[model samples]
Target: MDEWLKAGLDYVPRWIDYQVQHFAQPGCAIAVAHQGEVVLEAAFGTADLSTGEALTPRHRFRVASHSKTFTAAGILKLKERGLLRLDDGVGNFVPGLHPDIASVTVQQLLSHSGGLVRDGADAGQFTNHRPFLSTAELKADLVLAPPYGAAERFKYSNHGYGLLGLIIEAVTGEPYTTWIMREIVRAAGLTETAADIGLMTGGTLARGHSTRLPLGRRLVIPGDNLTNDVASATGFVSTAGDLVRFFSQLSPMSEAGLLSPLSRRDMTRGHWPDSESVLDRSYGLGIISGTLKGWDWFGHSGSFPGTLSRTAVFPAQGLAISVLTNAIDGPAQLWVDGIAQILKAFHAGGAPHEEVADWVGRWWMLWGAVDLVPIGGKVFASPTALTPPLAEMSEIQVTGRDAGKVIRASGFFSPGEAVARLRDGRGEVSEIRLGGTRLVSQSAFADELVARYQGFSKDRA
Candidate 1:
């Protein structure tokens, strides 16, 4: 194994130990890949606490919403074949489905900008319990309201995704699930992964168990079958390995043979600004765009009964990570770090070993007022305004590989505040500082003067 892989493997025991201490999770599965090669595929803990079936690399788990990327890719593949345009409005596909939804477009649906309410059914609606609604049925039953506006903004709408799935069925002349299997799944060669909603009732399925009490007394009940039939927006189960394989294609220079270069870029292009200042990180079609650890990555998070999953791919570093837990409340935060650390160790050689002067710069957050500016090649942070006596600093660090660099700093300046860091991607000294007191910092210090003030924008990753 390569040194990075060795390092990643070394951390597994530590991760397992940590999970045991923090969450008491039964078991966890993690997959990490770099430059199209999976260096680490290990499972720690138990797939079933009672049975003591040790989690293994071959184990499968429901990747919940992580299925969104596959479904979105299926829709985009149809677009690639001249079947539909994202700009095509929702009404065009689902004719007369909703009179109020005549103005919503497919792009809006993908980005969750469509003004569809989050849940169509009230709490007591599904009380006694019933079979899940089909895709078209879901669209009709759940889509109760109209778009808030024509402009796209981020508002997670499951109904919007359901509508997207419905459109897929209409355009492909097949059930949404069937079309996805033939076009995206088959094309991607994911034979083992599918929307197996009722796997528990059938053979060759992993039993899903919840960590907490059964909700509505329907615990351990078979998942709704509608989940698979109408999977365009949600509803798909996959293995960590297969998910890593599917998402590996999304990296900028990947060779996964799933998406063409043009298609990959098209999928990543920021279709709509998610918020005010973050131009780089936004939603496009069905994918979320952003940077992590200094690498431009794209993917989504998924959640369902007894499942929570997240998959991310760092394009510049040519790395991807996927984690799936059968438990309802998995170690989500630690899981992300575990994969990040794995990627960092595997691709450590590729990461910048020596700091560069150009790496020092200022960054502005998309939502916060903190500005990270480079001064004298060292790092300094000013909370409200960039002025003198800007507390010298402590524990400064920079992370993220080439093209996606962030500066992090901890201690003193902003007590109780998360260590501040410079945001990634932009060339100038402007960066968005995440996790600190949002005390509206103003850029009053002169740029040149700040540069000579012995403080660069400390990376607070």
Candidate 2:
């Protein structure tokens, strides 16, 4: 591994673990791949809060809406085999459809520009108020005319992907799940993936949890319901490790990939802007794309009732990252972006030398925690609460064995102030002093709080 990548990977797990504890999230899983090889796989917190089952990298998550990417790949694979074309009308394959919806081509549906209904009028299936729609119910909903014209703009529609599922069934004389599993998922060399919950076998499935606001406490949600007909849109289950592996192969720069270079380019090209949103993102064929830190990336995000997940592939950097969180309000997107920021910072700073290597540790104060991270021979005092911890960070220039000076920081922070590491009887660093404020180990801080504020000894408390 490159020294810069190694430096970033070394701190990613520590940062994520801190975030999980500080935010009280159910659990989070993360995986990263570089040049088609997985370099890191990690998980934090519990899979089921009721049982306290520790989340592991092997645990599977209901990666809803990522199923659309798989469905799009299946359609493109058929096109590669001369079985279908991107411009073919849906009405040609599926017999019954509203004229407007039927005229929507396969490419439009892939790009979410088909302007089909977002979901049928009664979308109780998503909320667990009712089971997922069956074939009969889905067909009944498709009979109605779409609210917008085909190719009007980027209007998201789960029903459009469902229609693509029916089209897959029509093109091949097999079920959507069966064909997609064999051709797309397996062809991409993924083992920890399934088209739907019913087909998921082996490995532990992480149970989802609701947010703690309205309920005052999290309740376990068994996210194992089967999506009957809409499985092609919102029914795929996978691990963070497998998700990165699968998405890495979708990069156009990848030499050995499932699709041809032309198909991959067309699929990932930003075709329609999300004009209604302020995110400055665009929708591609089965892909969502944007620029971060001057690097263009393409991937997908998924939202199930109890889970939120995201993945991003940076073709220029040859990197793919996936984050899975087993809670409705999990900050999966923020976590992924933060990881990218950390990597970019490390890449710019290079590797740390032995002089500052021992300066690494997470120290706490009354307000929150601060992480002393060593990168490129300098120490960075970063706050634990921030999504990208390096934001507004203080740079320390080590002057001696146990002394440093804060050379760069915000105006409110102690810039150009003396910093020192206090040692215990055994000569181990026990506390740190940044200017006038003192920070101690987490355990010591907790004990101090109980003893001073609560008026009780550690054992008594």
Candidate 3:
């Protein structure tokens, strides 16, 4: 890995952990891929708030609308095999659509321009207040008169993708899930990606939690609500690692990518701007394409009942990141965007620019841990707890062997404050005292913990 990328990867976990805790989310899983190499995979917080089961990278999230991306790939694959065409109308294969609705082309459905009702009046399936739509139930809705004009503009319609799923079956003689799992998921080498809720089993499925609503506190959703016939539109479970791995291949021109380059270009190229949206974002064929950090990228977001997920693929950088949250309120989008900004800042100036400062090291105190971090040739004392991840404690200038004095630590210590460093006879740093806390060396951490317990015991009521 390049030095800048390696350093940026190190920052990924710590920063993400800070944000995950800072937002007090139930849990978050993140993964990053650089040129097909999984550079980082991490998880934080509880999978089940009720049981307090800690989450791990293996945990699965209902990557809801990400299913559309897979479905789009399936359509393109069928096209590759001469089984279907993008211009084929929905009525071409699937029987019994309203004449107006049936004539909407395949590309139109993939890009959400088919003018189909999104969920018709009962989207309660998403919240488990009602069951997810059954095939018979979905068919009833599609047969109704078209509500919006075909090929008019972008209007997101999950039910349109559902119709596409039906079309997939009509053309392929195989269920959508079976074909996608074997052809797309397996072919992409994604072991953890599942085609639908029914197949997401035998592993750590993250229990999604509700956002705090007008009723008051957030509650845990069992997260096993079936996606039913809508799996092609909203049902898929995966890990962050698997998500990034899959999306990285969406740049089909990339090495060993699954989709034909022509298909990928058509899918990723923006087809319609999300009206009034300031982000310069547009909807493509099952993909969200836009500019980030001046790089044209394409990816998607999934919003399930109690989960939120976001992904991005920077084809220019050969990089991608996926963030999944078990909580409805999780800032998966913001976190992913922050990561992209961080990478841009690191990579913008060409090389790593300056070397890591000499003073950076781990330290221990009664409160917890603090890290002396070097960024851009300067040191900042970062408290692990009791402060944000990179809160400044003090910047110090070396004064003697294994010793330094405080130059400044905004909001923590005064300028010229003594940052006394005590060392063993071997000239190795043993402990550091600053801001009325003694940070013991790693070797002495056990002793400090013992002393902390003793202090706790003495102060007990």
Alpha-carbon RMSD, each predicted model: 14.3, 1.9, 5.1
Instruction: Locate the minimum summed-lDDT window of 10 residues in model 2.
Output: 451-460
- Per-residue lDDT tens digits for candidate 1, residues 113-213, read 77676646542212215444565566566445554665546776676777777788889898777777777877887756775465323223334456554
lDDT of 3 by residue, 327-389 (tens): 888888788877776676456533232443455567886566676655554445666543223
TM-score list, all predictions: 0.68, 0.97, 0.82
> What lDDT score belongs to each candidate, Candidate 1 first?
0.59, 0.92, 0.82
Candidate 2 clashing pairs, residues 3+ apart or interchain: none
What are the per-model numbers of colliding residue pairs? Answer: 30, 0, 0
Q: Which has the greatest TM-score? A: 2
Model 3 regions lying over 4 Å from their true place: 213-216, 349-355, 359-461
Q: Pick the candidate with the highest lDDT.
A: 2
Ordering by TM-score: 2, 3, 1
lDDT of 3: 0.82
